[model samples]
Target: MGTNRWKKYKIEMLPIKEPTEIEELSLENLVDQILNAKKLDPNADTTALEREIDQMVYQLYELTPEEIKIIEG
Candidate 1:
């Protein structure tokens, strides 16, 4: 019988910890974060998470750039 190549290595698994609280961000903040991310990586491909967030935000509020600024102020 052939010896196992990885028999000497010991693997340790860490316990997963639950979050203390669920932090919620306003639509404005989410939009700002998404815009900043896009600006930072304009050539990057669009992600499913980003698309989902965009859809959620769009459904909740259909505000223009001007309106977003007004709300932020």
Candidate 2:
């Protein structure tokens, strides 16, 4: 949260890219980039995408509806 390294990062953000390219990175790196993007752009919105991702993760793990509520809660 305190570092500025992400600000100087030159890679194109996946969401904003055209003819998208896959950049394999760890979850930590992905989260860092997301947080950094938020920091750099406070008005940036990704709520729908977040929910989509959550649903995908839940489906991937075959989590139950009850489990989803518990986990999301």
Best by lDDT: 2
Tell me the spans in candidate 1 whose CA falls farther than 4 Å from its real position. Answer: 1-25, 45-73
lDDT (C-alpha) at residue 30 in model 2: 55
- In candidate 1, what residue range of length 10 has the lowest lDDT sum? 15-24
* Model 2: ten consecutive residues of lowest lDDT: 17-26
lDDT of 2 at 34: 66
Question: What TM-score quantifies how close candidate 1 is to the native fold?
Answer: 0.30
TM-scores for all predictions: 0.30, 0.44
> What residue pairs clash in candidate 1, if any at all?
none
Using TM-score as the measure, the top candidate is 2
For candidate 2, the TM-score is: 0.44
Extract clashing residue pairs from model 2: none
